[model samples]
Structures are given as structure tokens and as C-alpha cells.
Target chain A: MNLTIREALLAFRRAPLLSALSVTTIAFSLFVVGLFGLVAVNLQDALRGVAERVEIVAYLLPGTPIEPITLATKDIEAFPEVQSATYVSEDSALARARAELVEFRDVLQELERNPLPASIEVKLRPRFRDADHVNDVAERLRGFGFVDDVRFGRDWVEKLDRLRQVAAAVGLVVGAAFAVVAIIIIGTTIRMAVLQRSREIAIMRLVGATNGFIRRPFLLQGAIKGMLGGLVAIGLSYGAYTLINRWLIQASFFSNEQAVAIVGFGTLIGLFGSAASVGRHLRRV
Target chain B: MIKFTNVFKAFPKGGLALKDVSFHIAKGEFVFLTGHSGAGKSTVLKLVYADEPVTSGEVRVSGFNAADLRPRDVPMLRRRLGIVFQDFRLLEDRTAEENVAFALEVTGARRSSIAARVMRVLTQVGLAAKAQAYPRELSGGEQQRVAIARALVNEPSVLLADEPTGNLDERATRGVFQLLRDINASGTAVVMATHDLDLVRQAPYRVIELQEGALVYDSAVDESRDQAATP
Candidate 1:
């Protein structure tokens, strides 16, 4: 093992031009895989992050008593999928409306008492926050006589699902394309290495070196190129992602803290995954 | 020890290169394999190294059946013998020392051992000073010597030289032949194939002559001449 590595390193050092060409080919292929990986992860994260915030709001009838609203909120909280639930009194809803319309807050001192209806806001656990889960909870809320309406964004949920599907489909197509490119590039590199050292191989055979021994360095070269290429792609993609996140923050898409929160741990997994897959593909050569 | 029994070799397109050939070389005996250009001298050397399979009949070299040897075991067979090609097939990218060291490296020898053996063989071939020079930078003689050093590094029992001095001048040719003689005297059997009849005549050794893919003569020159002169 030590001798194989030593010889491979020596071979690598001696063939600087071939080494550089191989690594460059590896890096370019890795970059494409990493780029696709980034898009897929970010889209999935966006969809999942939104689902985690999905909540159901059930507005009560105008004449419903505060006690029933409180009781209904407690009932919803007891469901296995429900994480938490709270009653929003009519007065609190009116206050929120006034805050949202600060420019028109006066308007003859809001003319009459707060007109918004009392509502129950129920936060579902992550597993119960998808479209069907929310709809199921919505139907249960509607069963109550005092409940006037139960709503969450059905259209937005569908849009998010479509985005996830598109992301997955595109990820598969692009990932496969990048994978093919990576293999071809690495195979061609190793093939050239083989051609360049044909005399060496022939001599090794003449010296009674087994086929395994002669093929070892080429396999090692393939593995090393794969690993290095993956690392280069990861570094470049991560650097680009960080730069984009910074630009978004500076452009006021979100504050620095918010932007940090939006770029989650998934992106990191994605970068490492892209590297590992590319490395695996290249090792076979 | 090496032996061939009615061995025949026919190329796919070139027809029979060796007819029903039969010969044997005992251990610790240096023999010259010589014939004209179209003769089967090189094919006989190739059989010993198991480079070409016999079309029929048995070829046993160093106790291994050459005709039935596995492809994977061919390298192992080669490692036990040293073969010098007419072209001095040295890696152009490697220095003389590196070319020799490469052989040891492929055999999984320790680096320190490889270095020591390489240095020792280079000195033996009178190329220790040129150890750092690439094959392209060396003369034809030096390149062939490097090739010989590579072949010798493994300390193979049999040394097969196929027209090793084909590309050298008279001085260099004499040097290579002397080196082979010295190596043979040390008890490693040397079987050299060459068309140079003068070298064979000058060098006091058994000569095996081939004609039309068959052994036409296998005996000491003085014995053959005495028999012919008496008849």
C-alpha cells in the first residue's frame, strides 16, 4: 500500500501536464454536479421550511361566546398532530388590523368597536403540516357549529409541491448528465495515462509484474482525481452559495440573521453528497 | 533448465514461424541461439520466456509448462527470467536508475532494497555514472545496458537476450557480449539469439542453429567440425 502510493505520487509528479489536465477535467465535472446539488437542496429546503410554518386559522361566528372559542382552541391543541393552539380575541384582531394600517389608524377613531371575529390559530407538528394534513384538520374544525371558516393557503401548498416535483425531476436529469460527463472525463484521463505509459506497462510485464500491479496505479490515479475533483467542486459551490447569500442580505432580501436562518444545514449535506457521488463514479476507472 | 518437444508456432496471418522444433538447455549452461534473419532463433527465445504459445507439442521452461501457463502467471514466469529486446524497450520518461527501479517496484520490493539493487546493477553494467540520465539522452549502447540492468535487477535464473547487440558498434557489441559472458560465468544461464555468426564463433560456447523453423544443428562447434572433416 505504501509503495503503491509512493509510486503513484512519483508518477503524478513526473507527469505534471497529464495530472493538471485530469484534475481540471475532474473539477469542471464536479462543479456542474455541485451546482445542481445546490439548486435541489435549496428548493427542497424552501418547501420544507414553509410547510413547517403552516397553520390553520378557524374564524368563529360573530355572536359566539369567548368561552366556546377558548374551548375550541383547547380541543384543537389536544389532537396528536397539533403542537399548539391559541384563541385570538376580537379586540386583538382589531388591534392587529390597526397596526397594519397605521397610516389610517385615526379614521374617526375607527368609527365603531373592533369588528374582526375571534379566531383560533392552530400550529401543526412538522409531519402534519402538509396539504392533506392541514386539510384534514380544517375539516375537523369546520365540524364545530360556531366555526364560520377554516383556511390555510391551498394554492400556495400546491405551488410548493409542484416546485418540489420540478426540482426533483430537474435534479435527476442534471445529476445524471453531470455523472456521465464526470465518468467520461475521468475515463478518458486514465485512458490517456494508460497510453502515455504503455511502454512502462509493457516493461513492467516483462519484469514479471502481475496485471494487478500494473493496473494499481491507474486505479489509484482515478480515485485520487475523483476525490480532488469533488473537493474542488464543493469548495467552489459553497463559496458561490455564501457569496450569493451575502448579496441577498445586502440587497435587503432579508437581514443578515434572517439570511443565515434561510440557508440551512441541508446545503452543507448537499455539497458533501455531490463530492462523494462524483468520487464514487471516478473510482471505478 | 528448459526443454521443448516438437513445438510448433504459426501466426494467425504469417503462417508457421516455427515447425516441429525440439531442443533442451541444461541449467548453468550458456548457449548461443543463432540463425539467419528468417530463421526461428527469436521464436525459440520467445518460447523460453513464454511470450508466444506453441501451436502444438510441449514447452517446459524452468519446470513450468509454457503451452499451458495461465495469462495471469505469465508475469511471474517473466520475473524468473530476464529478457533483453532488440529495441531496448525502456520507458522514455524514466531515468536509467528509475527504469531499473521500476522493475523492483512492480514486484513490491521495499524502496530501500530497490534503490540498493538498482545502484548495484547499474555499477555492474558500467552505467552507474549515467544512472540519472534518461534513455533518450543515452547512446544506443547505454540504453541497451539500462535495459539489461532492468532485466538483471530481479536476479532471474535465465537471461534471454534477443539480438541485444543488434544496434551497437563493434566496441559496444564486444562490451555487451563480455558482460553477458561474465554474468553467465557466475552460473546464471544466458541464452542469446543473434544473427552475428562472428560473435558466436569468437565466444567459446555451445551454439544452437535453426533453419526453416527447425533445429538443424545443436552441438559444440569443434565437435561438429571434427565430425565433418573426418567424414
Candidate 2:
């Protein structure tokens, strides 16, 4: 045990430049991949936040009975998908217009009567908040005898959903590619280590040391480099996130909690990636 | 003990290095394998350690069949024996004591036991004072002695030396020869390969001479038979 450690430390001392190169490569690759994942996670969160607020407004028909409008509100609210149904009377809608458009207030007073129609705003439950579910609910509400028009920004909701799916797919493909590149770089570093110590390995083999015994120091070196690289990558990622959030608020993405969770997951990836890289190359080395 | 029965060894490029050679070295015996440059002396040693497999015959060393042994088990077989080379294969980077301890380390020997065993072997080789000296700092004879100590550190039953004094002067050669004789006297079998007939005559115990990879002379049976007739 003591001799193995001594040998591993000697290997590090002898090849400082090679060890540094390997660690730097792992850190750089892991940082890029982690950054991509972080952005994707935050984007998904923001899109879901917007999507959850999606609700369709149903305007009542002119000359419709008051009892049916009240009954329609009760019916919409009873649906499993509807979170809430708030009735907006014609007078309230006109008042909201007058408050929102102060410059047009005088122009609105010139009119003899209010043209705004009574309506009900339907907010869907969280699980039913996606574009497809909202569109289905709006169509069902439009089937009511008193409903004249239904509006809920369906085009915008669909666009955001499409963007989310595309982002997820691209992230998966690119993430896999970068992982392979990182593993290859680690494997190359290990190969160089094996070549450098080929003489020592030959002597050990001649002295009846098994192949596993000869390959151990290199494996230990690779593992250490991997663990150190993962730590550096997480640190750099945290610093970048903090800098962006503090100065360039527009560029800020994830919450502090989300960043911590992502970095925790990324460290595991880095360790397993480097171990696999070393294992694949050990057979040939 | 090492035994080679009608063993044939052919290289990949074609041509036999050892052809139909047969011999046996008994326990506690010291024998010399004397031959010309390409007369298959080193190949015989390699075969004994299972470094090279037999082409068409049997090689049994310390009860293990060389040809039938698995590749993974070859190291275990080698661990039971000691081998020295013509170049005095010593790690130039390590000290004399480290070179000896390396043999024990590869087998996962204990750290506490290793120190005592290394010191014992260094003392036996008469290089106790040079334990901390590196190979580059040691003389050729001292380097060879370190190699011998490394071979003896494992306390193997059979010691195979391929021209241990190849790079030494007359005095150094005599010193190395005397060391081998002493090691053999301690009940360890020694098989040495050399072409120096004069050195072999000085301490004649048994001689197995090879010519074209064939066993041409074995002085054991011939000398005893002649002695019986003369009486």
C-alpha cells in the first residue's frame, strides 16, 4: 500500500505537464456541458411558469339572459381542468378599459353606450395548463349557447412548447457528443502515461507483477485528475453564474438552488466519465 | 527443478531455436548450460520460466507444465523462480535495497517484513554497506550482485542466471562465480548459461552442452560410467 502510493506520487512528480493538461481538458469540457444543461433547465422552468398562467377569455353574446351567464360560470368552474372562472360584467370590463386607456377616456365618454361585452376568464389547473389542453378546454367552452368568442393566445403557447422540445432534443445530442470528446481526451492522457512508463511496466512484468499491478498507478492518476477537474468545473460555473446574475441581469438564467443541484449532478458525471475512459484504454495500454 | 523433454521452439519468422532438446536439473544441483552464441541457452531459460512456450514438447518447472499454463498464470509460475540476465537487469533509478525489495513488493509482501528481508539479502550479497547506493553509483560487479540479491530475495528454489558475468573482468567474473557457488551450496538449484569452457573446468559438477539446439554432451552419466569402468 505504501509503495503503491509512493510510486503514484512519483509518477505525478515526473509528469507534471501531462497531468495538468489532462485536468484542464476535463474541466473545460465539463464546464461547457454543465453550462448547457443549466441553461436548458432554467429555460424549461421559465416556459412552464408562463404556460401555467395561460387562460382563455369567453365573451358572452349580446341580448343573452343573465341567468345563463351566471350558469355558464358555474359550469366552467365545475370542470376538472378549470382552476377558476371569474365573471367580468360588461360594466367592469368597460371600467378596466377606461383605467387602462386614460388618453382615450374622453373619446370613450363621447360614445353614448358601452360596447364591451360581459365575459368570463377561465384559468386551467396546473396539470392541464399546456397548449393542447388549453385549446381543448377553450373549444369545449365555446360550445356553450351564450359564448360568442374564445381567446387564449394559443399561437404563442404552442410556439413556446415547440421551442422547449427543440431545446431539450438539441441539448441531449450535443451533451452526448461533448461527453465523448471529454472521455477521449482523458483516454489520450492515460495512454501517454502508459507510454512514458513502459520501461517500468516491463521491469515489473519481468519481476512477476501481474498486468493489473502494473496498470494501477496510471489508473490512480487518472482518477485523481478526474475528481480535481470536476471540482474546478463546478467552481468556474458558479462564478460565471454569479457574475451574470449580478451585473448582466438580462443574461441571468437559473435560481441559486437550481445551480447547486445541477453542479451536484455534473460532478458525478465527470467522475464516472473519467473512470470509463481509463477503463476502456487500460486493455490496450 | 527444471525439465525439458524433446522440446522444440520455433520463432514466428520460422526456424527452430531449440530442436528436440531434453535435460533435467535436480534440486540442490548446480549445472552449467554451455553453448555457442545461438546455441539456444537463453531460450532454454525462457522456456523454464514460461516466457516462451514449447513448439512440440514438454517443459515442466517446479511441477507446473510450461506449455499448458494459462497466460494469466504465467506470472505465478515465474514468481516461484529467480532469473538473472546477461545485461544485469537492474532498475537504474532505484537504490540497491529498493531493487531487492521490488521482487517482494510485486507479490504484495508486507511492508514490515520487506525491510528485514531486503536487509538479509543485501547482507548475503556482501553489499550491506551499499544498500542506499543507486545502480549508476555501483560498480558492474556490485550491480550484478544487486541483481542476484533481488533474485534471492524471493528465496526461490531454482535460480537461473544467463551469463551473470558477461560484462565483468576476470576478477569480477570470479567474484560472481563464487557467489553462485555459495547460493547453490545453500540447497538452491542453479542453472547458469555460459560459453567459457575454462571457467566450467575449474568447478566441474555437471555440464549440459548444446549444439544446434540439440543436447550434444551431458558430463553427468558419461563421467560416472567412465569412473566405474576404471575401477
Interface RMSD list for the candidates: 1.1, 1.2
- Residue pairs in clash, model 1: none
Candidate 2 — which residues are off by over 4 angstroms?
Answer: A1-7, A35-55, A58-131, A143-148, A238-285, B196-198, B221-231
TM-score of chain B of 1: 0.93
Would candidate 2 be rated incorrect, acceptable, medium or high by CAPRI criteria?
A: medium
Best by lDDT: 2
The C-alpha RMSD in Å for every predicted model, in order, reads: 5.8, 4.2
lDDT of each: 0.78, 0.81
- Model 1's chain A TM-score stands at 0.75
Q: Write candidate 1's Cα lDDT for B1-231 as tens digits.
A: 888899999976978888888778888788999889879888888778877778899999887998679887788888889999889999888899999998888877877678889999999999999999999999988998999998899998899999999999999899999999988988899999999989999977888888888888888645778899995
CAPRI-wise, candidate 1 is medium
The number of the candidate with the highest DockQ is 1
Tens-place lDDT per residue, model 2, B87-166, is 88887778999889989999999888999999998999899999999999998999999999999998999999998888
